[model samples]
Target: MQYINFLPCEWNNDHGFTQEIFAIAIKNNIGIGNPDTVPYRKSQMKNSYQFLHKYKADINTITIAVQEPDYTYTNPKTSKKFTQAELYDFDKNYIGANIIFWNIQQPQFDSVLKFFANN
Candidate 1:
């Protein structure tokens, strides 16, 4: 099966937009209703930089990633053209953030990830 886009219907356009999204993370989650205000012991917090470095992963470390936008694709349903660029986001805290804003329309590189309404 082809990948289905989960973007909202209203977001359909010639190009896409950027926004903040919450991603699912697996870890221990102490109950919030615990009577104790400071419930379970506080686990050591690892900032974005710490997490990325722990896996020996960095944006610039990848060679097959998109570093420029040299092509564009059209939306089948809307016939609206959109730029096709592959990107992987790294935490801002990560010192080796090698983000490249391929398309000029895209805003300056940041920690947020961009997705198209039409996959």
Candidate 2:
């Protein structure tokens, strides 16, 4: 499944996250966490929630402000251009790295919002 990463930045509260990502999860009825949110919220929510170490299955999956070709991207770390399918596959399989989408145009952004909002 194609997903628009609403949780783009981690740790910094000034980043356009926390609220947006939580809103998305609330809307989608899905749960999410990250390097930043995990530590920050875990302590506060410990009494009511349980924290799990299931992130090895998915490392850092953040979308850059830009998108590459066909709304796809080139792996900044590898300088390799991977198709959407390939990228998602890489995300699932690669356990020790990060994937960033570069040069994203508005259309791609729209498609992402549509997928997230309507799906």
Candidate 3:
């Protein structure tokens, strides 16, 4: 059987929901679903990747959903938004580290489930 780890941005606030989803996904052999609402600094993303790798999780099997440039913020000090180029650049740089990108605006849940089913 396959197992998928679903991580939500609000996991800290909704542990029960998180656990429920994780359990269901694991039992069904589906893909993990991670929210794109939370901002993940480059360092944090790298550290997370490292931690997962350390735990023997296949990097290729992991995917991170991210908001579109219009919805993503530039920084805490300013209300500026990130450009598409910047977002692509960040993903490109991190892609080699074994992270796949998914646009949250799309029907990611179904798409991910299908992806896992096919793979």
- Best candidate according to lDDT: 3
Better of 2 and 3 by lDDT: 3
lDDT per residue as tens, model 3, 1-95 = 22223444543324455445444554555544333323345443433322333332433343444555424466443446653444444443433
How does each model score on lDDT? 0.24, 0.36, 0.42
| Candidate 3, superposed: residue stretches over 4 Å from native | 1-33, 37-58, 68-70, 75-79, 95-119
Give the per-residue lDDT digits (tens) of candidate 1, residues 2-118. 111223432322122211110111122211110111101122112222222342231223111222232333334445533332223221222223332333344522312344333
Q: Indicate the residue-level lDDT of 76 in model 1.
A: 42
Clashes of 3: 0
Q: Considering summed lDDT, which 10 consecutive residues are worst modelled in model 1? A: 30-39
What TM-score, over all chains together, does every model reach? Answer: 0.17, 0.24, 0.34
> lDDT of candidate 3?
0.42
- Model 2: per-residue lDDT, tens digit, 4-114? 233334433346454454445545555343221111133322311121122323323332222334334344455665444443443333322243443346655665555
Error of 1 at 41 (Å): 48
Question: At residue 100, what lDDT does model 1 achieve?
Answer: 29
